[model samples]
Target: MSDADYFKNMPHDKNDPNPFLAIYMDQSIPFNEEAKAAYLKDCSSRSRQFLLPVLRPFARLMIIVLQLYKIIVPKALTSSRLLHRVLHFGMKTFVSPSANFMILRHFYLGSEVLGFIRDNVPGVHIEMNPLKPTKLEPVKDDLFLIHDLNLYNFVINLNRELREKGTEVTAQKQLNFSSITSSRIPIEQMPRRWTNFMDLTTAIECFTPVYQLFLTDNDFWRATNSLQLDETIGILASKIIGSNDRLALINNKHPMVPLTTLKAGFRLVLHGLATEQLHALLVELKLKQQKEAAISS
Candidate 1:
C-alpha cells in the first residue's frame, strides 16, 4: 500500500494503535511492540520532515516580528542598560567595532532566533575556501571571523543595501497596533493601545516583503548547498553572507568546511541562543571535550 494511503487510513485518536503516533506517544518502549516497528518509525519521521520547508515561511515572519519588538521595546524588558553597556564596550574592545551594535541587539529574543536559524537551518551555508581544521585559533587573532548573534543586524544590513540603491520603505517600521480586551468594548477606552506599536498595520505591510525575501534566501542557500551547486568554500560563504561582511569572515578563508546535517542543525540553534545562553552551551561543550580527552589520555 502507498505511504500516503497508509497514513491517510491511520487512526488519529490518542487511544488508537496507530504506529505513526506511537513514536511520539510512547517514548519509553523498552522492547519492540510491532513486527515492523522500524517501518512505522520511518513513516513518523517523514511526517515531520516536511516541517522544515513548511515552517520556513512562518519562521521568517516570527523573526521579523521579533526584530521589531527588540528595536522598539525598552531595555528594561531585555536587560539592564549597565550590563548591556558593559558587553557593548567589551565586544568593541575585544571583537570588531562592527559587531558591537549586533551584540547589543543579540540580547533580544528576535535577534537570537534569527542567528539560530541562519546558523542552524540550510538558510546560510557560508563558504571559506581552502577549508582546513587546525588547532584552536585565538579569537584575538581573528575576531572578525566570529559569529554575530543579532537578528536586527540582518535587517539593518538589508536596509543599508536597499538605501544604497535609493529606495524608500515609507516608515512602515513605525506601525501602531490595537488589542481587543476580553471581547468587551468598554467604549470609553475604545482607542486604547491595541499593541505595543502605534502603526502595526504599516509595519506588517513593510515587514511582509522582507520576510518573504528571507524565506527565499533560506530556501535557495539550503537547496544549492545540498545539491553541490558550488564546490568552493568561497562561493558558499559568499552565498550565506550575501552583502553583509560586517558579521561573518567574508574576507577570511577556511581550509575545511563544516557541511553536515548535525553541524548545520547545531550552528542554527546555537546562533539563536542569547550571549549568556551561548556561553553556557560553550561551557558544556568544553566539559564534554575535557571528559573525552581525559578518557583518551
Candidate 2:
C-alpha cells in the first residue's frame, strides 16, 4: 500500500484560487469552468456523473425539506434507536451489496484523503478536542470509519479515552490510500444507486442562496455542521464505518465492514471519487512526463 506520504512533495498545480481545488487541480483534468461544467454531465451509466446530475433537482428540494424537517423534528438529528433501525432497514434491504461496498469504500478513501490533506496541506484546519465531562478513557472499539465528520467526533472522543495510554494511532484514517482502494472490492459496483452521493453538492449549489445556488463556505459549514445532516447520513460513513456498521478498518479505519453491516448503513460516494479522479490524473501526468523524458534523453 502507498504510504500517507506517498505523494509527499508531489508536484500539484497551484493555480486555483481555492487552496483545496488548487492542490487537486491539474492541467489535463483542469479544475476550471469547463470541468465545473462537466460536473453534471452524464458520463456513463456506471459513472457517478450519471445519477448526480439527476439528483441535483430533487436534492435541492430535499435540502429545504431537511431544513424544515429539522425545525419540526429536531430530535431526528440526534442519536435515535428507532431512526437507526429505519436507516439500517432501508440500507440493508433496499441498497445493493455492491453499492454498499462502493459507499463504504468511498468513505474509507475519503477519510484517508481528508486526513492526508490536513496533514500535507496548510490552512485546511480540522481541529478536535477530547471528550470531556467523563473519566473513562474513550471507549476503545473496533469500529471502522466512513465519514470524516464522524471521525472528527470519534477521535476527539476516542483519543480522549486513549490519552496517555501509550497506544499507537489506531484510528482508521491514518492508513495509506491504497489499503482500501487496491483491495478486492467488486468492480462495476453499481449502475443506479448512491443516495447521499450528490446531497452535499446539491445543498451547496441549488438550495442555499435565493439565487438559491451553491453554498460558498460559511453556509457549507452551517448546513452540514449546524443542520447535522451528516448525522442523518452518518450511518454509511459513520455508524456503518464506526460507532456501528463497517466503514472503519486498519486498526479501525483500514478495516472492512462485515457484508452483514451493509444491512444498516448510509453514506456518500461522489465527492471522494472526484478527489481520487484528480489524483489519478496527476499520476498520469507524471507517467507521461517520464515517458517523454526517457525518449528525449
Query: Could you say which candidate leads in lDDT?
Result: 2
Candidate 2 has its poorest 10 consecutive residues by lDDT at 133-142
Any idea what lDDT model 1 has? 0.31
lDDT of 2 by residue, 45-157 (tens): 23334555664566556555554555555444342233334434443444433333333444444444334323332223445322211111111111111133454554454
The C-alpha stretches of model 1 lying farther than 4 A from their native spots are: 1-44, 74-76, 79-297
How many collisions between residues are there in candidate 1? 25
Q: How close is candidate 1 to the true structure, as a TM-score?
A: 0.18
